[model samples]
Target: MNNPFPYSEDNKRYYTWSHYLKTKYKNKVFKVALNANFTCPNRDGTCGVGGCTFCSSYGSGDTIEDKFEPLDVQYESNLKIMQHKWPKGNAIAYFQAYTNTYGSVKQVSEMLKPFLFKDEIVAISLATRADCLSDEMIEYLDFVSRKKDIWIELGLQTTNDKIAKSLNRGHDYQCFLETVERLSKTNLKICVHLMNSLPGESKEDMIQNAYKVGQLPIHAIKIHMLYILKDTVLGKSYLQHPFPMLDKDDYIDVVVSQLEVLPKHIIIQRLTGDGMRGEQIGSEWMFKKTIVLNDIDKAMVARNTWQGKVLETK
Candidate 1:
C-alpha cells in the first residue's frame, strides 16, 4: 500500500501530523484559541436570545474568564504547550471559541495587535458563524490574508434548515452560501465545520448535506459527531428519548460514504472532536477519542478508501 500523501501511508485516509500541516516550513504550527470576548448576534437579541443550543455561553473549546488577561499571555500559554509537546513547531493564533469577526473593526484590530509582529505565529484561523462576518470583517480578513495566511472556519452543523432552526443557528442555508460567496472573494482559505449524528437527521440526510458542502468553495473540512453535552437543550432532549447515536461502526460507514463524495483536495482538518467528557452526556464512546479516530483511519485504510469515492450527479 503506497499513497504519496503523508495522510495515506497505508493507502487509506488517515490523519498524520506531517500530512495534516502540509507545510514547507519543516515544522509544526500551533493553534491558540483566543478568547476574543466577542458576543454573538443571537445573544444580543438581534437574531435570538440564547445562541445555538449546543454552544455553551463561553462558546466551545477550553475557555477562561478573566478578560483582564492580556492577549499575549493567552498566546504565550498556547505556544508554550505546543513547543513543549513538539519542540520544533511554530504557532498559529486561532481566534476560536466565539464569533471572532463579530466586533467592530477597531476592536478586532486591537484584539489581534499582540501577535501582529510575532514571527512564530505564521497564520491565523478564525472560528466564527456564517452571519457574523460583516463587510468590515471581510475587509479585515482580506488585509490580514495579504500579510499572513488566514483560515476562516464556518460552522455549518447540518444543511437541514429545520435542524439549524432547532439549534437556533440564527442563519439559514442561503446565508451560508452568501457568506461563502463573500469570503470567496478574499484570499483567505475557508474551512467548514460539519456535524454528524445531529438530532432529526437521517443517514440519507447526512449524505445529502455532505455532498452539498463538497460543492461549496471550501478549502478544508472538519467533521464532528454531535454529542449532547450537559446543561444544553440537546442534552435534555436526549435524556427524554435517547434516540440512537452513531456508534463506532455506524460512524465509520457514514464517514467513508461522506468522504467518497467529498473533494479529495480539501484537507481533512479533523475526523472528530471530543467535547469535554465531564460536560458530555450520553454517547460515552466519544470519550475514547484517539481509539475512535484511529479505528476510523484503520478501517478506511483497510478498504483503500478516500473521501468522495461515491458521488451521484444530480
Candidate 2:
C-alpha cells in the first residue's frame, strides 16, 4: 500500500525525525548525545526531592559511556561512534542528560559556546525542564540560533496534573504552556516529550495528551513508554506493590491512535525508549523495538489512517 503521509518517504504513517533531518539537511544527519553534567530542580532541593519517580540515577543518561568526562571529550567520542554508522552525516550536539538549562545563563553559555562554531555540528538540542528556562536563557538561545539551529527539548510526560503530581514532576501543564508560548517567539525549535502508560493514565488520557500538545506551536514530539527501572522510586514501588503495565499489543494500539491526532507537520522524534537491560524491572516487550514499531505501521495501514487524520475530520 502507498504511504499517504505527506512528510514521509516510506510506509511510515507518521512523520519520522529521520525524514525531517534528511529533508532539511539534504543528506544524513544524526544526533550525538552529550552529558553536560547538569542537575534537575526535582533532584536537588530547588523543586522537591528524589527526582522524577521513573528516572534512573543517571538522570536518563544511561546510554552515555562516560558521562563525567568534559564536554569536548564526550562529543568527540560519541561523534566517532555515530560516524562509524553514518560516516558522511552531519551531527546535532544533543545535550541529553539532566536539566541542561537549570544552571545560570553564563554557565549554559560557556557549556554551549565551543560547539556553536564547530564545523561538524549542524544543530544543538538541549533536554531541559519547562521551569528551568529563564527569559535570559531564551534570549541567549534565540541569539545563538541565528547562527545555528537550536532545539529545546522539554519533558512534559503527561498532561494530567494529578498524574504529574503523582510522578513528582516539578511543574504543572500550565507551566509547560507558558514556557512553550515564551519559546515560540524565538528562533529555537521546540520538542516536547510525552509518555504513555503512566500510572493512572488510561489510553484515552494518552490520546488527549497528544491531541492537546499537537495544538501548540511545537516543532516535534517524542512519545515514550514508561519503562520501570530498578533504581527509581517507581521501580521500588512496583517491586513492593505491582501495578498494571501496557502489553505490546495495547501499546501499539495507543501509539497509532496518538499519531492520528498529531499534526502532520510536527516531527515524531521517537515512538518508544530504550531501558538499560540490566536495570529494567518491567516492560520486557519494549526490548523488541523493531517489532513494536513495525506493528504500529501495520495497524495504521489496516485502519486506513495517517497522522492528522483525526484532526482533518475535526
Deviating ranges (above 4 Å) for candidate 1: 4-20, 63-68, 311-314
What lDDT is reached at residue 206 by model 1?
86
| Residues forming the 10-long window of minimal summed lDDT in candidate 1 | 9-18
Clashing pairs in 2: none
Scored by lDDT, the top model is: 2
lDDT of 1 by residue, 270-302 (tens): 777777758887677877878877888777777
lDDT of 2 by residue, 1-314 (tens): 57778876765888999989988988899999999989899899888999999998889898996689998999999999999999988999999999999999999999999999998789999999999999999999999998789999999999999999999999999999999999999889999999999989999999999999999999999998999999899999999999888999999899999999999999999998769999998678899998888888889999999999999997
Residue-pair clashes per prediction, in order, are 6, 0
Over 4 Å off, model 2: none
Among these predictions, the greatest TM-score belongs to 2
lDDT of each: 0.77, 0.92
Return the lDDT, model 2, position 204. Answer: 96
Worst window of 10 by summed lDDT in candidate 2: 1-10
